[model samples]
Target chain A: MGSATPVDDEAALIAQLRAGDESAYEQVVRTYGGRLLAVTRRIVGSEEDARDIVQDAFLNAFKSVGRFEGNSKLSTWLHRIAVNAALMKLRTRKRKPEQSIETMLPSFLEDGHHEERFKSWDEPVDKALERAETRQLVRAKIDELPDGYRTVLVLRDIEGLDTEETAKMLGLSVNATKIRLHRARQALRTMLAPHFAASGGGKATP
Target chain B: MKCRELADFLMDYVSGELPEEHRAHFELHLSRCRNCHEYLAQYESTVKAGRIACGEMSDELPGDVPEDLVKAVLAARKLDPAK
Candidate 1:
Protein backbone atom coordinates (compact mmCIF):
# COMPACT_ATOMS: atom_id res chain seq x y z
CA MET A 1 0.00 0.00 0.00
CA GLY A 2 2.02 2.96 -1.32
CA SER A 3 5.41 2.39 0.26
CA ALA A 4 8.97 2.93 -0.93
CA THR A 5 9.47 -0.80 -1.39
CA PRO A 6 6.56 -3.08 -2.27
CA VAL A 7 5.17 -5.42 0.37
CA ASP A 8 6.24 -8.40 -1.72
CA ASP A 9 9.77 -6.99 -1.88
CA GLU A 10 9.82 -6.45 1.88
CA ALA A 11 8.51 -9.98 2.40
CA ALA A 12 11.24 -11.39 0.19
CA LEU A 13 13.86 -9.35 2.01
CA ILE A 14 12.59 -10.54 5.37
CA ALA A 15 12.64 -14.11 4.14
CA GLN A 16 16.18 -13.70 2.88
CA LEU A 17 17.18 -12.20 6.22
CA ARG A 18 15.56 -15.05 8.13
CA ALA A 19 17.36 -17.50 5.92
CA GLY A 20 20.71 -15.95 6.94
CA ASP A 21 21.57 -14.37 3.66
CA GLU A 22 24.60 -12.04 4.00
CA SER A 23 23.50 -9.85 1.09
CA ALA A 24 20.21 -9.20 2.82
CA TYR A 25 22.08 -7.83 5.83
CA GLU A 26 24.17 -5.58 3.60
CA GLN A 27 21.05 -4.38 1.84
CA VAL A 28 19.46 -3.38 5.11
CA VAL A 29 22.55 -1.47 6.13
CA ARG A 30 22.84 0.34 2.82
CA THR A 31 19.18 1.27 2.76
CA TYR A 32 18.74 2.45 6.33
CA GLY A 33 22.14 3.55 7.57
CA GLY A 34 21.98 7.24 6.64
CA ARG A 35 18.55 7.88 8.14
CA LEU A 36 19.19 5.78 11.25
CA LEU A 37 22.42 7.68 11.84
CA ALA A 38 20.62 11.02 11.46
CA VAL A 39 17.98 10.08 14.03
CA THR A 40 20.53 8.82 16.54
CA ARG A 41 22.81 11.83 16.09
CA ARG A 42 20.04 14.25 17.05
CA ILE A 43 19.35 12.34 20.27
CA VAL A 44 22.91 11.44 21.33
CA GLY A 45 24.35 14.83 20.21
CA SER A 46 27.50 13.42 18.66
CA GLU A 47 28.08 12.10 15.16
CA GLU A 48 30.66 9.54 16.28
CA ASP A 49 28.42 8.21 19.03
CA ALA A 50 25.55 8.18 16.58
CA ARG A 51 27.52 5.95 14.21
CA ASP A 52 28.29 3.51 17.00
CA ILE A 53 24.63 3.53 18.03
CA VAL A 54 23.46 2.81 14.48
CA GLN A 55 25.80 -0.16 14.30
CA ASP A 56 24.47 -1.41 17.60
CA ALA A 57 20.87 -0.89 16.44
CA PHE A 58 21.49 -2.89 13.28
CA LEU A 59 23.03 -5.67 15.29
CA ASN A 60 20.13 -5.61 17.71
CA ALA A 61 17.64 -5.67 14.85
CA PHE A 62 19.45 -8.60 13.27
CA LYS A 63 19.32 -10.61 16.48
CA SER A 64 15.58 -9.91 16.82
CA VAL A 65 14.64 -10.07 13.12
CA GLY A 66 12.85 -13.40 13.46
CA ARG A 67 10.40 -11.85 15.86
CA PHE A 68 9.67 -9.02 13.46
CA GLU A 69 6.37 -10.26 12.00
CA GLY A 70 6.05 -7.26 9.69
CA ASN A 71 3.15 -5.81 11.67
CA SER A 72 4.68 -2.45 10.72
CA LYS A 73 6.95 -1.37 7.94
CA LEU A 74 10.60 -2.38 8.29
CA SER A 75 11.70 1.29 8.29
CA THR A 76 9.36 2.05 11.18
CA TRP A 77 10.81 -0.85 13.16
CA LEU A 78 14.32 0.31 12.31
CA HIS A 79 13.48 3.88 13.37
CA ARG A 80 12.36 2.63 16.78
CA ILE A 81 15.53 0.56 17.12
CA ALA A 82 17.68 3.60 16.34
CA VAL A 83 15.75 5.73 18.83
CA ASN A 84 16.18 3.08 21.53
CA ALA A 85 19.86 2.77 20.77
CA ALA A 86 20.27 6.52 21.19
CA LEU A 87 18.35 6.45 24.45
CA MET A 88 20.56 3.67 25.71
CA LYS A 89 23.62 5.72 24.82
CA LEU A 90 22.14 8.71 26.60
CA ARG A 91 21.57 6.66 29.74
CA THR A 92 25.17 5.51 29.75
CA ARG A 93 26.64 8.97 29.21
CA LYS A 94 27.68 10.96 32.28
CA ARG A 95 24.43 12.44 33.56
CA LYS A 96 24.25 16.16 33.98
CA PRO A 97 21.41 17.87 35.85
CA GLU A 98 19.37 19.70 33.27
CA GLN A 99 18.64 23.39 33.73
CA SER A 100 15.01 24.21 34.52
CA ILE A 101 12.83 25.46 31.64
CA GLU A 102 11.11 28.06 33.82
CA THR A 103 13.87 30.55 33.18
CA MET A 104 13.17 30.30 29.43
CA LEU A 105 9.40 30.66 29.45
CA PRO A 106 7.64 33.83 28.32
CA SER A 107 6.47 36.14 31.05
CA PHE A 108 2.96 37.57 31.38
CA LEU A 109 1.81 40.47 33.53
CA GLU A 110 -0.64 39.98 36.40
CA ASP A 111 -3.34 41.31 34.05
CA GLY A 112 -2.68 38.57 31.42
CA HIS A 113 -0.79 40.65 28.88
CA HIS A 114 2.77 39.97 27.77
CA GLU A 115 5.31 41.74 29.94
CA GLU A 116 7.23 42.60 26.77
CA ARG A 117 5.35 42.54 23.51
CA PHE A 118 6.92 40.50 20.72
CA LYS A 119 7.98 42.63 17.78
CA SER A 120 6.67 41.55 14.43
CA TRP A 121 9.26 39.33 12.81
CA ASP A 122 8.86 40.86 9.37
CA GLU A 123 11.31 38.51 7.68
CA PRO A 124 9.73 35.11 7.45
CA VAL A 125 11.51 32.64 9.75
CA ASP A 126 12.26 30.41 6.78
CA LYS A 127 13.97 33.30 5.04
CA ALA A 128 15.97 34.09 8.15
CA LEU A 129 16.86 30.46 8.63
CA GLU A 130 18.04 30.22 5.03
CA ARG A 131 21.05 32.27 6.04
CA ALA A 132 23.79 29.87 7.12
CA GLU A 133 24.55 31.95 10.20
CA THR A 134 20.92 31.91 11.33
CA ARG A 135 20.67 28.20 10.67
CA GLN A 136 23.70 27.66 12.90
CA LEU A 137 22.15 29.83 15.55
CA VAL A 138 18.94 27.81 15.46
CA ARG A 139 20.84 24.55 15.81
CA ALA A 140 22.86 25.89 18.73
CA LYS A 141 19.65 27.06 20.41
CA ILE A 142 18.12 23.61 20.06
CA ASP A 143 21.20 22.09 21.65
CA GLU A 144 20.73 24.41 24.63
CA LEU A 145 17.41 22.81 25.49
CA PRO A 146 17.41 20.21 28.29
CA ASP A 147 17.64 16.72 26.85
CA GLY A 148 14.08 15.80 27.73
CA TYR A 149 12.61 18.80 25.91
CA ARG A 150 15.04 18.53 23.04
CA THR A 151 14.24 14.88 22.48
CA VAL A 152 10.52 15.56 22.42
CA LEU A 153 11.05 18.44 19.97
CA VAL A 154 13.18 16.29 17.69
CA LEU A 155 10.72 13.41 17.68
CA ARG A 156 7.56 15.44 17.23
CA ASP A 157 8.68 18.52 15.29
CA ILE A 158 11.74 17.34 13.44
CA GLU A 159 11.07 13.69 12.74
CA GLY A 160 7.37 14.37 12.05
CA LEU A 161 6.23 11.57 14.33
CA ASP A 162 2.72 11.94 15.77
CA THR A 163 2.34 12.81 19.44
CA GLU A 164 1.13 9.35 20.49
CA GLU A 165 3.96 7.55 18.68
CA THR A 166 6.49 10.01 20.04
CA ALA A 167 5.08 9.59 23.54
CA LYS A 168 5.29 5.80 23.27
CA MET A 169 8.86 6.02 22.03
CA LEU A 170 9.94 8.16 24.98
CA GLY A 171 8.00 6.10 27.54
CA LEU A 172 6.13 9.31 28.32
CA SER A 173 2.39 9.83 28.40
CA VAL A 174 0.79 11.83 25.60
CA ASN A 175 0.17 14.73 27.97
CA ALA A 176 3.77 14.78 29.07
CA THR A 177 4.88 14.72 25.46
CA LYS A 178 2.69 17.69 24.67
CA ILE A 179 3.93 19.58 27.69
CA ARG A 180 7.56 18.98 26.85
CA LEU A 181 7.03 19.82 23.20
CA HIS A 182 5.27 23.07 24.05
CA ARG A 183 7.94 24.05 26.55
CA ALA A 184 10.63 23.20 24.04
CA ARG A 185 8.97 25.37 21.44
CA GLN A 186 8.58 28.18 23.92
CA ALA A 187 12.18 27.96 25.00
CA LEU A 188 13.33 27.94 21.41
CA ARG A 189 11.24 31.02 20.71
CA THR A 190 12.86 32.73 23.66
CA MET A 191 16.27 31.86 22.31
CA LEU A 192 15.31 33.15 18.88
CA ALA A 193 13.68 36.37 20.09
CA PRO A 194 16.82 38.45 20.19
CA HIS A 195 17.41 37.90 16.53
CA PHE A 196 13.85 38.48 15.47
CA ALA A 197 12.75 41.21 17.86
CA ALA A 198 12.77 44.89 16.92
CA SER A 199 14.08 47.24 19.58
CA GLY A 200 10.79 49.24 19.79
CA GLY A 201 8.04 46.85 18.61
CA GLY A 202 8.30 47.89 14.97
CA LYS A 203 8.91 45.28 12.30
CA ALA A 204 12.59 44.41 12.04
CA THR A 205 13.03 44.97 8.35
CA PRO A 206 15.12 42.11 6.96
CA MET B 1 -10.47 34.65 24.97
CA LYS B 2 -8.13 36.56 27.22
CA CYS B 3 -4.36 36.46 26.55
CA ARG B 4 -3.75 34.23 29.57
CA GLU B 5 -6.40 31.76 28.48
CA LEU B 6 -5.00 31.62 24.96
CA ALA B 7 -1.44 31.24 26.21
CA ASP B 8 -2.43 28.40 28.49
CA PHE B 9 -3.90 26.35 25.64
CA LEU B 10 -1.84 27.61 22.70
CA MET B 11 -0.16 24.28 22.17
CA ASP B 12 -3.46 22.48 21.97
CA TYR B 13 -4.67 24.85 19.28
CA VAL B 14 -1.42 24.60 17.30
CA SER B 15 -1.46 20.81 17.49
CA GLY B 16 -5.07 20.63 16.32
CA GLU B 17 -5.94 18.72 19.48
CA LEU B 18 -8.53 21.20 20.74
CA PRO B 19 -12.17 20.09 20.27
CA GLU B 20 -14.10 21.67 17.40
CA GLU B 21 -15.96 24.06 19.66
CA HIS B 22 -12.76 25.08 21.39
CA ARG B 23 -10.99 25.46 18.06
CA ALA B 24 -13.77 27.66 16.70
CA HIS B 25 -13.61 29.85 19.77
CA PHE B 26 -9.82 30.04 19.52
CA GLU B 27 -10.01 31.10 15.89
CA LEU B 28 -12.62 33.69 16.69
CA HIS B 29 -10.39 35.14 19.35
CA LEU B 30 -7.49 35.25 16.88
CA SER B 31 -9.66 37.13 14.38
CA ARG B 32 -10.36 39.82 16.96
CA CYS B 33 -7.11 39.89 18.95
CA ARG B 34 -3.98 41.24 17.31
CA ASN B 35 -1.66 40.38 20.18
CA CYS B 36 -2.75 36.76 20.41
CA HIS B 37 -2.55 36.49 16.63
CA GLU B 38 1.06 37.73 16.63
CA TYR B 39 1.93 35.42 19.50
CA LEU B 40 0.44 32.54 17.57
CA ALA B 41 2.49 33.44 14.52
CA GLN B 42 5.64 33.52 16.64
CA TYR B 43 4.80 30.14 18.11
CA GLU B 44 4.26 28.72 14.62
CA SER B 45 7.52 30.31 13.48
CA THR B 46 9.34 28.55 16.29
CA VAL B 47 8.09 25.21 15.07
CA LYS B 48 9.03 26.06 11.50
CA ALA B 49 12.53 27.19 12.47
CA GLY B 50 13.01 24.02 14.47
CA ARG B 51 12.11 21.83 11.53
CA ILE B 52 14.50 23.76 9.29
CA ALA B 53 17.28 23.30 11.80
CA CYS B 54 16.60 19.57 11.83
CA GLY B 55 16.59 19.43 8.05
CA GLU B 56 20.09 20.90 8.13
CA MET B 57 21.20 18.18 10.51
CA SER B 58 20.03 15.43 8.17
CA ASP B 59 21.61 17.26 5.25
CA GLU B 60 25.06 17.14 6.88
CA LEU B 61 25.50 13.38 6.46
CA PRO B 62 28.88 12.42 5.09
CA GLY B 63 29.00 11.11 1.58
CA ASP B 64 30.53 7.89 2.85
CA VAL B 65 29.57 6.31 6.14
CA PRO B 66 32.35 5.07 8.36
CA GLU B 67 33.72 1.81 6.92
CA ASP B 68 34.62 0.62 10.40
CA LEU B 69 30.94 0.60 11.37
CA VAL B 70 29.92 -1.71 8.54
CA LYS B 71 32.98 -3.90 8.97
CA ALA B 72 32.41 -4.29 12.69
CA VAL B 73 28.76 -5.22 12.29
CA LEU B 74 29.39 -7.72 9.52
CA ALA B 75 32.23 -9.27 11.49
CA ALA B 76 29.95 -9.65 14.48
CA ARG B 77 27.32 -11.24 12.23
CA LYS B 78 29.79 -13.96 11.29
CA LEU B 79 30.00 -14.81 15.01
CA ASP B 80 26.22 -15.20 15.41
CA PRO B 81 25.14 -18.72 16.36
CA ALA B 82 22.02 -18.56 14.20
CA LYS B 83 24.12 -18.09 11.07
Candidate 2:
Protein backbone atom coordinates (compact mmCIF):
# COMPACT_ATOMS: atom_id res chain seq x y z
CA MET A 1 0.00 0.00 0.00
CA GLY A 2 2.82 2.32 0.74
CA SER A 3 5.00 2.90 -2.42
CA ALA A 4 6.91 -0.31 -3.09
CA THR A 5 4.63 -1.65 -5.77
CA PRO A 6 1.12 -1.13 -6.99
CA VAL A 7 -0.56 -4.40 -7.92
CA ASP A 8 0.16 -3.66 -11.59
CA ASP A 9 3.87 -3.19 -10.88
CA GLU A 10 4.09 -5.89 -8.20
CA ALA A 11 5.05 -8.66 -10.56
CA ALA A 12 7.92 -6.60 -11.95
CA LEU A 13 9.04 -5.74 -8.44
CA ILE A 14 8.88 -9.36 -7.38
CA ALA A 15 11.03 -10.33 -10.34
CA GLN A 16 13.54 -7.67 -9.46
CA LEU A 17 13.53 -8.76 -5.83
CA ARG A 18 14.00 -12.34 -6.90
CA ALA A 19 16.85 -11.31 -9.19
CA GLY A 20 18.53 -9.75 -6.14
CA ASP A 21 18.98 -6.44 -7.91
CA GLU A 22 20.65 -4.04 -5.48
CA SER A 23 18.37 -1.22 -6.58
CA ALA A 24 15.31 -3.42 -6.11
CA TYR A 25 16.35 -4.25 -2.55
CA GLU A 26 16.90 -0.57 -1.92
CA GLN A 27 13.56 0.31 -3.42
CA VAL A 28 11.76 -2.31 -1.34
CA VAL A 29 13.37 -1.04 1.85
CA ARG A 30 12.66 2.61 1.13
CA THR A 31 9.10 1.82 0.12
CA TYR A 32 7.96 -0.47 2.92
CA GLY A 33 10.44 0.06 5.76
CA GLY A 34 8.55 2.83 7.51
CA ARG A 35 5.27 0.99 7.17
CA LEU A 36 6.74 -2.25 8.42
CA LEU A 37 8.38 -0.44 11.32
CA ALA A 38 5.03 1.00 12.29
CA VAL A 39 3.37 -2.41 12.18
CA THR A 40 6.06 -4.12 14.24
CA ARG A 41 6.58 -1.29 16.76
CA ARG A 42 2.98 -1.33 17.91
CA ILE A 43 2.98 -5.07 18.37
CA VAL A 44 6.26 -5.33 20.30
CA GLY A 45 5.69 -2.07 22.22
CA SER A 46 9.35 -1.08 21.94
CA GLU A 47 11.15 1.10 19.41
CA GLU A 48 14.38 -0.86 19.59
CA ASP A 49 12.71 -4.24 19.32
CA ALA A 50 10.54 -3.05 16.45
CA ARG A 51 13.59 -1.97 14.51
CA ASP A 52 15.23 -5.35 15.04
CA ILE A 53 12.04 -7.13 14.11
CA VAL A 54 11.72 -5.18 10.86
CA GLN A 55 15.29 -5.97 9.97
CA ASP A 56 14.69 -9.64 10.66
CA ALA A 57 11.49 -9.51 8.67
CA PHE A 58 13.25 -7.97 5.70
CA LEU A 59 16.02 -10.56 5.81
CA ASN A 60 13.47 -13.34 5.98
CA ALA A 61 11.52 -11.86 3.09
CA PHE A 62 14.63 -11.77 0.92
CA LYS A 63 15.53 -15.36 1.77
CA SER A 64 12.08 -16.53 0.88
CA VAL A 65 11.53 -14.25 -2.12
CA GLY A 66 11.81 -17.18 -4.48
CA ARG A 67 9.06 -18.99 -2.70
CA PHE A 68 6.68 -16.04 -2.89
CA GLU A 69 3.87 -16.97 -5.25
CA GLY A 70 2.77 -13.39 -5.82
CA ASN A 71 -0.65 -14.53 -4.63
CA SER A 72 -0.90 -11.39 -2.51
CA LYS A 73 0.16 -7.80 -2.79
CA LEU A 74 3.79 -7.10 -1.93
CA SER A 75 2.74 -4.90 0.97
CA THR A 76 0.44 -7.58 2.32
CA TRP A 77 3.23 -10.14 2.11
CA LEU A 78 5.64 -7.86 3.91
CA HIS A 79 3.00 -6.91 6.44
CA ARG A 80 2.37 -10.52 7.30
CA ILE A 81 6.08 -11.18 7.74
CA ALA A 82 6.46 -8.17 10.02
CA VAL A 83 3.42 -9.19 12.07
CA ASN A 84 4.66 -12.75 12.41
CA ALA A 85 8.06 -11.51 13.52
CA ALA A 86 6.50 -9.28 16.16
CA LEU A 87 4.27 -12.11 17.44
CA MET A 88 7.26 -14.44 17.57
CA LYS A 89 9.21 -11.90 19.57
CA LEU A 90 6.23 -11.65 21.90
CA ARG A 91 6.20 -15.41 22.39
CA THR A 92 9.88 -15.51 23.29
CA ARG A 93 9.66 -12.52 25.63
CA LYS A 94 6.78 -13.92 27.66
CA ARG A 95 8.68 -13.50 30.91
CA LYS A 96 7.92 -9.75 31.01
CA PRO A 97 5.20 -8.71 33.42
CA GLU A 98 1.84 -7.71 31.94
CA GLN A 99 -0.99 -5.78 33.54
CA SER A 100 -4.34 -7.42 34.13
CA ILE A 101 -6.97 -6.36 31.59
CA GLU A 102 -9.64 -6.41 34.32
CA THR A 103 -8.35 -3.21 35.89
CA MET A 104 -8.94 -1.27 32.70
CA LEU A 105 -12.36 -2.73 31.88
CA PRO A 106 -15.56 -0.86 32.66
CA SER A 107 -17.11 -1.18 36.08
CA PHE A 108 -20.88 -1.69 36.33
CA LEU A 109 -23.03 -0.65 39.28
CA GLU A 110 -25.37 -3.05 41.04
CA ASP A 111 -28.18 -2.00 38.73
CA GLY A 112 -26.01 -2.72 35.66
CA HIS A 113 -25.38 0.93 34.97
CA HIS A 114 -22.04 2.62 34.41
CA GLU A 115 -20.31 3.62 37.61
CA GLU A 116 -19.42 6.87 35.84
CA ARG A 117 -21.59 8.85 33.47
CA PHE A 118 -20.53 8.75 29.84
CA LYS A 119 -19.47 12.05 28.32
CA SER A 120 -18.97 12.77 24.65
CA TRP A 121 -15.57 13.98 23.56
CA ASP A 122 -14.91 17.71 23.60
CA GLU A 123 -14.86 17.51 19.82
CA PRO A 124 -15.42 14.75 17.31
CA VAL A 125 -12.96 12.06 18.39
CA ASP A 126 -11.48 11.56 14.92
CA LYS A 127 -10.92 15.27 14.50
CA ALA A 128 -9.67 15.73 18.06
CA LEU A 129 -7.16 12.97 17.47
CA GLU A 130 -5.57 15.22 14.85
CA ARG A 131 -3.45 16.61 17.64
CA ALA A 132 -0.18 14.70 17.84
CA GLU A 133 -0.31 14.70 21.62
CA THR A 134 -3.75 13.12 21.66
CA ARG A 135 -2.56 10.48 19.23
CA GLN A 136 0.43 9.78 21.45
CA LEU A 137 -1.82 9.47 24.47
CA VAL A 138 -3.92 6.99 22.55
CA ARG A 139 -0.83 5.02 21.59
CA ALA A 140 0.40 5.04 25.17
CA LYS A 141 -2.97 3.83 26.44
CA ILE A 142 -2.92 1.08 23.81
CA ASP A 143 0.54 0.06 24.89
CA GLU A 144 -0.69 0.08 28.45
CA LEU A 145 -3.13 -2.67 27.55
CA PRO A 146 -2.01 -6.16 28.55
CA ASP A 147 -0.27 -8.01 25.72
CA GLY A 148 -3.21 -10.30 25.06
CA TYR A 149 -5.61 -7.43 24.73
CA ARG A 150 -3.15 -5.14 22.98
CA THR A 151 -2.34 -7.67 20.31
CA VAL A 152 -5.98 -8.36 19.67
CA LEU A 153 -6.69 -4.63 19.45
CA VAL A 154 -3.80 -4.09 17.09
CA LEU A 155 -4.64 -6.93 14.72
CA ARG A 156 -8.40 -6.74 14.71
CA ASP A 157 -8.93 -3.01 15.11
CA ILE A 158 -5.83 -1.36 13.68
CA GLU A 159 -4.51 -3.92 11.26
CA GLY A 160 -8.04 -4.74 10.14
CA LEU A 161 -7.54 -8.46 10.31
CA ASP A 162 -10.64 -10.63 10.45
CA THR A 163 -11.70 -12.13 13.78
CA GLU A 164 -11.14 -15.65 12.53
CA GLU A 165 -7.67 -14.81 11.23
CA THR A 166 -6.72 -13.10 14.47
CA ALA A 167 -8.04 -16.01 16.49
CA LYS A 168 -6.02 -18.47 14.43
CA MET A 169 -2.88 -16.36 14.71
CA LEU A 170 -3.25 -16.04 18.48
CA GLY A 171 -4.32 -19.69 18.87
CA LEU A 172 -7.65 -18.70 20.39
CA SER A 173 -11.22 -19.38 19.36
CA VAL A 174 -13.17 -16.75 17.40
CA ASN A 175 -15.32 -16.17 20.46
CA ALA A 176 -12.23 -15.76 22.62
CA THR A 177 -10.73 -13.29 20.17
CA LYS A 178 -13.95 -11.28 20.12
CA ILE A 179 -13.99 -11.19 23.93
CA ARG A 180 -10.39 -9.98 24.06
CA LEU A 181 -11.06 -7.31 21.41
CA HIS A 182 -14.12 -6.05 23.24
CA ARG A 183 -12.30 -5.85 26.55
CA ALA A 184 -9.39 -4.15 24.84
CA ARG A 185 -11.63 -1.51 23.26
CA GLN A 186 -13.45 -0.99 26.55
CA ALA A 187 -10.18 -0.61 28.43
CA LEU A 188 -8.87 1.91 25.93
CA ARG A 189 -12.12 3.88 26.13
CA THR A 190 -11.77 4.09 29.90
CA MET A 191 -8.15 5.19 29.71
CA LEU A 192 -8.86 7.91 27.17
CA ALA A 193 -12.04 9.15 28.84
CA PRO A 194 -10.38 11.88 30.84
CA HIS A 195 -8.41 13.20 27.91
CA PHE A 196 -11.32 13.51 25.51
CA ALA A 197 -14.23 14.13 27.87
CA ALA A 198 -15.92 17.55 27.60
CA SER A 199 -14.47 18.30 31.05
CA GLY A 200 -11.70 20.17 29.17
CA GLY A 201 -9.68 17.36 27.60
CA GLY A 202 -9.97 19.34 24.37
CA LYS A 203 -7.82 22.10 25.79
CA ALA A 204 -5.15 19.67 26.91
CA THR A 205 -3.61 19.82 23.48
CA PRO A 206 -4.41 23.40 22.40
CA MET B 1 -32.42 -4.31 29.28
CA LYS B 2 -30.14 -2.87 31.92
CA CYS B 3 -27.15 -0.82 30.76
CA ARG B 4 -24.88 -3.67 31.80
CA GLU B 5 -26.74 -6.19 29.70
CA LEU B 6 -26.73 -3.83 26.75
CA ALA B 7 -23.02 -3.20 27.27
CA ASP B 8 -22.44 -6.92 27.24
CA PHE B 9 -23.78 -7.14 23.68
CA LEU B 10 -21.65 -4.22 22.51
CA MET B 11 -19.14 -6.48 20.89
CA ASP B 12 -21.80 -8.04 18.70
CA TYR B 13 -23.76 -4.83 18.45
CA VAL B 14 -20.86 -2.89 17.02
CA SER B 15 -19.89 -5.70 14.68
CA GLY B 16 -23.51 -6.01 13.49
CA GLU B 17 -23.50 -9.61 14.65
CA LEU B 18 -26.18 -9.16 17.31
CA PRO B 19 -29.16 -11.41 16.47
CA GLU B 20 -32.13 -9.80 14.69
CA GLU B 21 -34.47 -10.81 17.48
CA HIS B 22 -32.20 -9.10 19.99
CA ARG B 23 -31.56 -5.98 17.88
CA ALA B 24 -34.96 -4.41 18.58
CA HIS B 25 -34.70 -5.18 22.25
CA PHE B 26 -31.23 -3.67 22.32
CA GLU B 27 -32.35 -0.50 20.54
CA LEU B 28 -35.28 -0.21 22.89
CA HIS B 29 -32.86 -0.03 25.79
CA LEU B 30 -30.63 2.45 23.95
CA SER B 31 -33.57 4.66 22.98
CA ARG B 32 -34.72 4.79 26.60
CA CYS B 33 -31.34 5.12 28.28
CA ARG B 34 -29.29 8.24 27.71
CA ASN B 35 -26.35 6.64 29.48
CA CYS B 36 -26.35 3.56 27.28
CA HIS B 37 -26.74 5.57 24.10
CA GLU B 38 -23.83 7.85 24.96
CA TYR B 39 -21.79 4.86 26.00
CA LEU B 40 -22.36 3.13 22.65
CA ALA B 41 -21.63 6.27 20.65
CA GLN B 42 -18.45 6.97 22.63
CA TYR B 43 -17.40 3.35 22.42
CA GLU B 44 -17.70 3.44 18.61
CA SER B 45 -15.75 6.70 18.49
CA THR B 46 -13.05 5.17 20.61
CA VAL B 47 -12.59 2.36 18.10
CA LYS B 48 -12.21 4.81 15.20
CA ALA B 49 -9.76 7.00 17.09
CA GLY B 50 -7.68 4.07 18.22
CA ARG B 51 -7.29 2.78 14.66
CA ILE B 52 -6.30 6.21 13.37
CA ALA B 53 -3.70 6.74 16.08
CA CYS B 54 -1.95 3.44 15.56
CA GLY B 55 -2.19 3.57 11.76
CA GLU B 56 -0.88 7.15 11.54
CA MET B 57 2.73 6.11 11.83
CA SER B 58 2.69 3.85 8.80
CA ASP B 59 0.92 6.38 6.61
CA GLU B 60 3.43 9.14 7.26
CA LEU B 61 6.92 8.54 6.06
CA PRO B 62 9.78 9.13 8.52
CA GLY B 63 7.20 9.36 11.36
CA ASP B 64 9.47 7.23 13.53
CA VAL B 65 11.50 5.14 11.13
CA PRO B 66 15.03 6.42 11.40
CA GLU B 67 17.24 6.96 8.33
CA ASP B 68 19.88 4.67 9.76
CA LEU B 69 17.47 1.77 10.08
CA VAL B 70 16.90 1.73 6.32
CA LYS B 71 20.60 1.84 5.60
CA ALA B 72 21.24 -0.96 8.06
CA VAL B 73 18.68 -3.22 6.42
CA LEU B 74 20.17 -2.67 2.96
CA ALA B 75 23.69 -3.29 4.28
CA ALA B 76 22.53 -6.45 6.04
CA ARG B 77 21.21 -7.84 2.77
CA LYS B 78 24.71 -7.77 1.27
CA LEU B 79 26.61 -9.34 4.17
CA ASP B 80 23.89 -11.86 4.98
CA PRO B 81 23.36 -15.13 3.09
CA ALA B 82 20.02 -14.14 1.62
CA LYS B 83 21.54 -13.78 -1.84
- The number of the candidate with the highest lDDT is 2
Top TM-score prediction, candidate number: 2
TM-score versus the correct structure, for each prediction: 0.86, 0.91
lDDT of 2: 0.82
The DockQ-derived docking category for candidate 1 is acceptable
TM-score of model 1 (CA atoms): 0.86
What tens-digit string does per-residue lDDT give for candidate 2 at A1-206? Answer: 34444336778988988888888887777777887887788888898999999998988999899999878788888988999889989999955677687876667777677776676777888788778888878888988888889999999998889999899888899989999999999998888888888582121111
lDDT of 1 by residue, B1-83 (tens): 66777877899998777888878778888898787788889999999998886673434442344567767778888886354
**Which is the leading candidate under DockQ?**
2
**Collision pairs in model 1:** none
Which digits, one per residue and each the tens of the lDDT, describe model 2 over residues B2-74?
8788989998999899999989999999999877887798789889988888774423443334679878988
Model 1 regions lying over 4 Å from their true place: A1-8, A197-206, B56-58, B61-64
